[model samples]
Target: MEYKWIDNFIDGLIDVYGTKDIYELYDSLEISIRKLPKCNILLQGNEAFYNRNFLNKEVVFIRDDLNMEYEKFILCHELGHAIIHTNIITSAFSRNLLNLNKLEKQANYFALKLMDLNMDEIAFEGFTIEQIANSFNLPVKCLKLLLDSKNQNI
Candidate 1:
């Protein structure tokens, strides 16, 4: 089946949710995922999850023991999968990118799009990838690739 593109998904969500800031979007997802439903179980695990038929749902697995940016990124990435790949109706990727090439790309693209970052600001603002990553408190490699892709697009 032909997949519905992620841009369309985000556009629709934006229309319903109004224009939310990038961090706010992340924060909202963070809030929603943290409060896992008991029986309805939109999220099934703290490590990760993907519902083939579910429109948009994911678990970030942010337990108290995991206190790190990488842990935070897990939530972001799971949200990315939900937002970008839900229509595919199945997933075959591991948490590590080495096993799942396509999900890795999709997740990164969704993350950057959700951040609402662009090349003009990133290139002209004199902020290095590290600076941007630091400001966002995200992993540097993630920011680096996102900025690089934006540069290539420009």
Candidate 2:
């Protein structure tokens, strides 16, 4: 089943945020990330969490221990949840695992969409998969998932 709302949400983001750049989404949406107390267990294990206030202000509590690239991806994913699932102001935690649940999948699609990444721009003709991902500052594992999703959609 197609989740049409995801597309609508993307449009809303572009209209409201005035840009499709992933790095600017948080500031555009007035969302903030708090440095959560880094538990080695949580940091070493890959987990990010987000919550929305009663006033609808959103804050993502992330492990500061995460590398910059991973942190950016998590911010996008959490922003996805905040925008696409507005009613879900309740706290949620996400792990860097291949979660195929509806919400998780929607958030993944949202992240990819916000990134504005297209296969055509990837230019994989002569470059290795790692090269393409590296050039895009993408996590190889997540990029592979996006690639798979894009291919399936095509």
What C-alpha RMSD separates each model from the true structure? 7.2, 4.7
Cα lDDT tens digits, model 1, 11-48, are: 77678767545446656654344533333343444444
| Backbone atom clashes (below 3 Å) for every candidate | 1, 0
What lDDT would each prediction earn against the true structure? 0.56, 0.70
lDDT of 2 at 87: 64
- Those runs of model 1 whose alpha carbons end farther than 4 Å from true positions after fitting are 1-4, 19-32, 35-59, 65-74, 87-99, 118-128
Q: Point out where model 2 deviates above 4 Å.
A: 40-46, 54-57, 89-100, 120-141
lDDT of the structure predicted as candidate 1: 0.56
Flag clash pairs in model 2: none
Q: On residues 48-147, what C-alpha lDDT tens digit does candidate 2 reach at each position?
A: 7667772576777788777776667777888888877766534244333324376777787777767767676535788877888786676676677677
User: What RMSD value applies to candidate 1?
Assistant: 7.2
Best by TM-score: 2
Itemize residue pairs with steric clashes in candidate 1: 46-61
| Displacement of the residue 35 alpha carbon in candidate 2, Å | 2.5
